[model samples]
Every structure is written in structure tokens, then in C-alpha cells.
Target: MSVTEYRQASAFGKRREPHTVIIARGDDIRHFTIRPWLAAFVGSVLAAMAIGYLLATSYLVLRDDLLGATAARQARMQQAYEDRISMLRAQVDRITSRQILDQQLVESKVSELLARQSQLTQRHGRIGPILDRVKGEAGGLPESAPLPASKPELRAANQPVIYADSSAASFWSKRPAPSGPETAADRADRLFVAINQSLRAIESEQMDGIGTLTENAFKTADEIASALEAAGLPVDIDTDDEAVGGPLLPIDAGMIFEARVRELDEALEKLETLKAIAKEMPIHNPAPGKPVTSSFGVRRDPIIKRPAMHAGIDFRAPTGTEIKSAGAGKVIKAGWNGGYGRMVEIDHGNGLTTRYAHMSRIRVSQGDTVDTGDVVGEAGSTGRSTGPHLHYEVRRNGTAIDPLRFLKAGKAIGKLL
Candidate 1:
């Protein structure tokens, strides 16, 4: 039906009729009548009341369960959040501890490197001048020239140019400490990386310096060896022959750097020892500006008037002429012998000795330490001589070799000195 017809029918029906309900139970009967709209309204009210009662009852019965479930879910969420927080805290603690340890290691390395560099600087200060003197004596390159550039220098020179980054110390020092929790971890990470890079650069420089120093040490050692060989004395070189055996322990960069420094120190010590030994040996002119009167070996003895092996050379000098020691040594004999009157015998180390015979006066006593060029006595014809002359002999293990060899060697070495 159309909407207007339906509405008209509903209006007529509401105006015309009232409905009645009757109930009969056993001996009683009841009847009631009402308008249709009022009955419908009363039925609706009854249905609404019944539904409200049911909803109220259900809410009373199930309210505790619903609230308990909600509380349990909230507690689980809280526990989960707590567990997550604990895990994150643990991770943060571990990361913080690791970073602290790394920082400590880097600081220690930096301290060690600083100490090593200081030592190297001191050594360079002390040894550089001595090396220059040695090179001057050896006729090596001029002192102003760069000391024979090494492989490290060559490599550095050949390397391509690189942009420099900010210095770690400055960068870290300038940065303010993070105030917020969110950025603290990131800041720590950056700090560790920067520190690591700085340490690497410092270690690299140290290694390169060690390489150059080692090369120079070897070169110096070679020169010393050659000098000692020319003197016919065996060189005592350090041969690090001790065996190292273990479970193959691992070594870090710092240990290697320290070992190189130690090696350089040993080499320098050896060089010093060699220099001291060379100074004490007999290697200087004994009687300067004196004419040779007699040569060594077989000659006619002036007193005996027969051919005899002359063990010493004779230098003609006027009476009271100064007789100097050839090298620094302890005097062993200074009194008169049967043929050698007022003689002086010097005990140079290593079984080498030099004797000056026929002196007019002995200036040094036995057991007195005399240095090279120190006046030991006066030249005179005191014993077994036809004229005032100094008889000089070089003895090795109580047997006399030609003294001319040592004189010639001294003359050659004196030019260098």
C-alpha cells in the first residue's frame, strides 16, 4: 500500500477500537479492556522492564570476571614492560662497561706511546751529535744532509695526499657531554671510534720511526765493525740467539713497538762500548817530530858488536825530550832493567803492552794510569845505547810485533779523528 493509505488506516484504527483481555483460572474470572494504543504501550513497557531486569542480573553476575580479566591483562602488560626495561638496561650496562674498558685501553696505549716518544726524543738529542762527530771522523756525508733517508720516509713521500680529519683529542674535548639519555649511547660510540683511530695513527708513526732508527743502528754497527777489523781486533757483536718457545702466545702492537725500541737501545749501547774500547787501545803517535835512529828486527847491537834480533825501534831525540804514552793504559814497569834503563811499560788491555826504554828520567810510576799523549819519561841514552834515543816496542802476549804497524794505523786514523 501507499504510505498515505497506510497512515490513514492506522489513524482510523487507533480512534475506533479498544481491546480487552480476559483471564480465567478455576473459579475466578477477570476481564479488562483498553484502547489499542494504550495496550501496545503497556506491552512495550513490560517488554522493556523484562529486558532491563535481565541486563541488570547479567551485569551483577559477570562484573567480577570482566574486571578480573582486564586487571590480569594490565598486569601482564606491566610485567612485559618491566622485562623489556630490564633487558634494555642490561644491554646498556654491557655496552657502557665495554666502552669504558676500551677507553682505558686506549688511554694506556696513548700513555705508553707518549713515554716511548719522549725516550726517543731524548735519545735523538744525545746520539745525534755523537753520530755527527762519528760521521765527520769517518768521512761520511755532511752533517747538514738528511741522515740517509729510510724506506719509511720514501714510502711517506710517495703516498698520495689525504684530507686530514679532526684530531680525536680536540674533537672529544670540545664536545659537551650528552645530557639526555637518548643520545648518551651514540655519543659514547662516536668517542670510542675516534679514540681508536687516533691510537692507530700514533702507533703507525712510532713504527715508522723505529724502522728508521733500526736502519741507522745497523749502519753505525757496520762502520764500527769495519774500524775494529782494520785494527785486527775481533768485534764483539750482539747476536740475539736466545730461543723463545711457548704456546705461541699472541702479541699486540704495543709489545712489538716496545721490542723495537729495546733493540735500538741495545745497538746504541754496543756502539758506545766499541767507542770506549777504541779509545783505550794504543793508536796514537808516541814521540811526535822525532827521527828514527834504528829500525826494528835484525840489527848490529852497539854494545855486543854482533848481529842480534832488535825487538824495538829507536827514535833519536835529545836528552830531556818528552816521551809520551801511545794510548791510555796502566803503567806496569817504570824502573831500570839491566839493558833498558828508566823504562816504562804500559799494560794496554787485551794482552797488548808498549815499552819505552832508555829514558833519562821516568815520570810515571808503576800502576799509574796514563792517557795517550801523556809524558811518561824523558828520552836519554841511559842503557845499551850509543846516543840519546827512545826505544819503543809493542808486545802482544809477551811477543813483540813490529811497532811500525801500529804507528802507521794511528797516523791513518788520526786524520779521521
Candidate 2:
């Protein structure tokens, strides 16, 4: 049995009373006393303890949920970080691939340009000998002024970039990694610019060489024409003074190079034509390495001692020495002529003729085509010749001029030979 006791105090009295609680279980009883202030204090402590236990229980019951939420948030953050890294890697790969493609394209163009430069070099080699020949012929001519020193040297663009794998190397080395796409792209762009500049330089050099060749060809043609005119022969000079007419078209680097090549070809053709004309002209020495015994113009006649006009120059050669044709022509007369025994007359075209007088034997008949070095007869003291001397005459329309003029022209032509 259990019984509880409560004691009340009077309002005016100072006496304190206690409340007692009894509890019995299986014939056992327990009593507890509680004062007003003590009860209040104990009740407050118990209520505080109960509140704390409730709060702790609530936190324990919800701990898993809270922890799961925090873990989920952390997982999401890690996923976001991984995705960003993946995106960065993809961006880097794309940029690298694009850069490689651009580099390959530039290399291809450089290869083509290098091939063209090689072709130009070969053409220059072929023309070198011809230029040397022209220079030799024009030894007395004034030298051309040197080109400007400021001319840029031709650059071969085929050289590869030094830092081809710089971007890849930056990833591993201590050097700062690439900041962004702009850095890689800028490097490729710089390479392209360098190649383009090199191509332009080569093109400029080719243009200069073409110009020089054209000038040399023109000079040579003019010199040949001048020499022909000075020989008192009417030269039918062909001039290309007409203006060319065509529609204006856009020109590229390859087109410019082709145009230069065409110009060089035309110049070479004109030079060749002039060379042929000069070859056919009577400008070769009849008796090479032989001393001149008598000169043309007013001189005392060898047979008749009188101050008279000598229409031909005489060459002193040994008896029976080979006499070659001065120029390529057809022998018109090979038999005896008045005052010129054993005379050989070659009728060259353009109203020019060469006469070789005083020969021992006539080896060529009339209507025979004789080259410049072909043996026509043997030298001898025949007809007006005094003693084993040759009388050579260059006549234009049958009017004799100085044969020395034609022989002097031979000096210029000999250089080409």
C-alpha cells in the first residue's frame, strides 16, 4: 500500500511544511518528502532533463536523413567538378586537333612553294650560259647598274616550326599550362603568317630575275642590230612595239609566277631569233689568225704603183692553205673571172655577197651551199693577188664596202662560238 501526505502552512505563520509521498510494492512501502521550494527546484531539474532527453532522441532519430542529405550534396558537388574537368579536356582536344589541321595545311602550301622555287632555280641555271655569252659579246658595252641593296632575300618556307609540340609539352613541364584556346590558336596563326611572307619573298626574287633576263635579251638584240646597221647593210629589224590588249583579271601567286615564266620564254625566243639573224650575216673572219697584208680604201695598188682605191682587204696566207667561206651562203660563181682568177663569189641573202679571190684550186662548184667553215678553195697567188695573199670583199648590192668592218664584227660573234 502507498499513501501520500501533504502539509499546508498558514498564510501568516513562518513555519515550513513538507509534502511526503509513499509507495508500496509486495508489502513494501517507500516515502519521499518534498518542500515547496525543493519541489519547485527538483521539478524544474526533471523537466529540463526530460526536455534534453527529448531533444537528444529527436536528433538521433533524424540523424540518418540529415547525414544522407549532406552526403548527396557532396556527391553532386563531386559530379559537377568531374564534368567541368571533362569539358576542359574536350575543349583542349578540339583545339589541338584544329591546330594540327591548320599546321598541315600550311605545310602543304609550303611544299608547293618550295617546288616552284626549285623550278625557278633550274630555269636560271639554263639561262646562265646564254647570259654569259651575251655578256662576253657585249664586253665593250656599259655595265648595267646593280640592283638595290634593300631588296629582300628569298626565304624558303619549307622549314618546320620549332615548337610544334610546345602545347603538349606544356602539360607536363613546370612551365605554366596553357591559359585558354587563344594561346594555341595564336601560335598557329603566327606560323601561317611566316609561311606567307616567305612565299612572297620568293615570288619577288623570281620577278627580279625575270626582269634582269628580259633586259639582257633586249640589250643583246639591240647590239646585234646596231652592228648590222653599221656594216652598211639594210637590216629589216622587227620591233614589238604594239600594246597588248586583254581584260583585267585577278592574279594570284601562282599566276604571277607563270606570267614571269612566259615573259622569260618570249625574251629567250626573241634572243634566239636575233642570234639566227646574226649567224646568217657576213660577220665571220675569212682568214682567221692571218695577218692583213693590205687594207681597203685609198692605197697604192700592188701591181700598178698608183694611189688608187683598193675595194677589198688582203690576207697573207701560205700557198695551198685551206680557204673557208666567210659566212654560210651558196657559191654563185666558182670559175675564172676578169682580173680575179679562180675567184669564188658567195651570194648571201639580203643583197650581201662575199668574194674570195686568188685561189690555187676551186673545190666548190656553183650552186653549192657552203657553211661558214666549209673549205671552198686553196689559197694561192692567182689573178690580182701578189704572193699567196687573199683578197676578201664584202659588197652590198655589188657596191664594195670595207671588208674590215665585217671581220671586226666577227670578233663579237666569236665569243658566242
Candidate 3:
């Protein structure tokens, strides 16, 4: 058993006093007095120990909860990081796919452009020769004026927005890289557009050439017809009575190039026929460097000294001077006829004839072919003439026509040829 009692402080000091303790074990009693300072010290030590024990208990109970919360926060952060990575990967894949598609489309367009260029080159090779021939026949100008040798190119458009990418190096190399404000795809598009423009230029030039040829050919034909009409000859090129027949099959109007080529060919053919006819017509002067002694129509006769209709022009040629045929023809009468002595009548085609009279000697016999400027006979005053002269007469369908008209037309025709 133990008993402890605390004595009050003294009235004078108002401070803590001593504490007495009694302990009895088996009737043995002992007493001990603790001083005021020692009692206060003991109480303070006990209070500090109680507070320390409570703080340790609180820390031990909350440690697991704190650790769990930190782990959860770390897990959320890792998941967020993974989601971000997945999004970035998808974006990269989409970009890559788009780039690939663009590259493929560009390649396809390039191939088509190349193929078209080859075809245009081949067309130029054929059209160049045709254009040369047309220019030669047109005498420098066709229709209105000369056409441009090469067609102009198409103009460019507004610039496109360029994007950034790592895979831009695999494209065209001729255009040095670090290209400003334009991507590889845009550059390729520009190249293809230029190529198409070049092809269109080629097509335009070809069409222009065809049109020029057609115009010139028609003009030539018209001029030739006019010449033949003025010279009292027929433009014997038959167009309406040609034997042409075919089934009315479907025609392709889209084939503009081929259509133009065909049109040019037809015009050239018509012009050629007119040219042939003009070539055969009598448009040449029979006597070179010989002055006209007598004009045709209502002239005083040189021998009779009376007014009479002169059917031909008389060229003052010396005796035995060479006389050439007026034009291409076949001789029908090479011997004498009536007062026109030593007459040689040539039957020119298309209901026409020429009379070369007053000749001393005939070189071409009947049924013999004679070309223009061919020496037909030697000149002498054998016909009804007073002096040594060559009488040249042109007759259309057995009717005497003026020879001056044919000679004048020949001068105009020489310019075109």
C-alpha cells in the first residue's frame, strides 16, 4: 500500500510546497518528502510523454491512406501520357497517308502529260511539212496575213498555300529544293499545267496552219477561175458532177484536227485542178520582141487598103523567123486554108483553137502534140498579108475572141505562181 499527500504552499510565498508519500508493505511503514521543485519537474515529464505517445499513434494510423492516394495520382498521370501518345501517332499516320495519295496522283498526272507531249510532237512532225507547202504556194501571206510560227503559251494562276512535311525530297529534282512558299505537290501540279499549255499551243498552231492553207487554196482557185473567164476560156475543173458516194455513217465532230486536215486537202485538190487548166490555156505571147503591125477588130486592110474586120494581131517578123505556138495543143490542120495561106490551126482542149498563119515552113504535122513556146513553123508573108508578118488568132468554140485579154491575164497569174 502507498499513500501520497501534497501540502499547501506557505501563505507568505504563494509557491508550490513539498509532497509526502507513505508506503507500507507487511506493516512496515516508510515516509518520503518530495521538494516543490522536484514535484513540478516530475509532472512536466509525465505530460510530455503522454503527448509524444498520441502523436506517434496518429502518424501510424494515416500512413497507408496517404501512400494509396499518391499511387492513384501517379497512375492517372501515366494514363494521360499514354492517351496523348496515341493521338499523336494517329495524326502522324493520317499525314503519311495523305502524302502518299498526293504523290500517286502527281505521278499519274505526269505520265499523262508525257504521253500527250509525245503525241503532239508526232503531230508537229506531220503538220510542219504541210505548213511549209502551204506557205510556198500562198506566196508569203495566207488569207489575210501570215500566221505565227509558234502559238503562245497560257498564263499562270494565283499562288497556292504551301504546307510543311518531312517527305518532300522524293519528287522532281530539276527544280532545286528549299522551294519558297510552294510544296512538292504544288510544284508538280504547276509542271503538269505548263505541259498541258504546251500541248494546247501545239494544237492551236496546227489548226492555224490548216486554216491558212485552206484559205490560200480557195483564193488561188478563185483567182484562177477569174483568169480563165477573162481569157474567154472555161474553168474546166468539175466539182458538182464528181462521182462520190458513201453511206451516211456517224461522223465524229470532235475530231477537229482530222477535219481541218481533210478540208485543207480538198481545197488543195481544187486549186490543183484549176492550176492545171490554167496551165493548158493559151496565155502566152506567140512572138517574142515583135511589135504588132496590125491590131484586131475594124482595121484597114494592109493589102486591100479598105476597112475590114481583122480577126488576128499581126506581128512584124522577118522572113524565116521562128514562130512558136501560143499554147499547148494538138495540131488538127497544119496545111493551107482559104486566103489565110500556109495556115496551121491547133485544136486546144475545151472547145478552143489557135490559128498560126502566114508561115513558110511547118515543123509540127497534123495530130502532133505541141506545147507552149514550141517552135511550130518559120514566119513568112504567105497568107493574105502585104509584108513578112506572123498572124496570131485565138478562137473560142469557132468564134474569134480578143487575144489581149489572155495576155493581160497571164501577167496577173504570174504573181501567184
Worst 10 residues of 2 by lDDT: 1-10
The total number of steric clashes, by the backbone 3 Å criterion, in model 1 comes to: 0
lDDT of 1 by residue, 179-235 (tens): 766464474455445444544444455456556655555565566556656766556
lDDT of 3 by residue, 1-417 (tens): 112222233334555446899898988999899887887789999999989888888778877788888998999999999999999999999999999999788888878877766666665665666656665666623446454464233334343312122233233334564547887677677766655655565566667767876887778778878877877676766657478888876665237677887777777778767666666678877888899877889987767789999898889999899988878899999988767789888888877889989888888899999887899998987867677888999998899987878877876775654
Local accuracy by lDDT, each model:
0.71, 0.72, 0.74
Ranking by lDDT: 3, 2, 1
What are the per-model numbers of colliding residue pairs?
0, 0, 0
For candidate 2, what is the lDDT?
Answer: 0.72
Lowest lDDT sum, 10 consecutive residues, model 3, at 160-169
Angstrom error of the Cα, residue 109, model 2: value is: 5.6
lDDT of 2 by residue, 1-417 (tens): 112222233434555557999988978989898778988999999999999999999999999999999999999999999999999999999989987987887678668757765765665565455445445444422356222222334444457423324553354355554577666556655555555455444555556756776676666667766776776656675576688678999998657656766665675566666667767677887777899988989998767899999889888999888888888899999988877888999988888899988888889999999887788998888786668877889898899989888877667555433
Sort order, TM-score high to low? 3, 2, 1
> Each model's TM-score?
0.48, 0.66, 0.69
Off by over 4 Å in 1: 1-218, 222-256, 288-295, 299-307, 316-319, 408-417
Best candidate, TM-score: 3
Least accurate stretch of 10 residues (summed lDDT) in model 1?
148-157
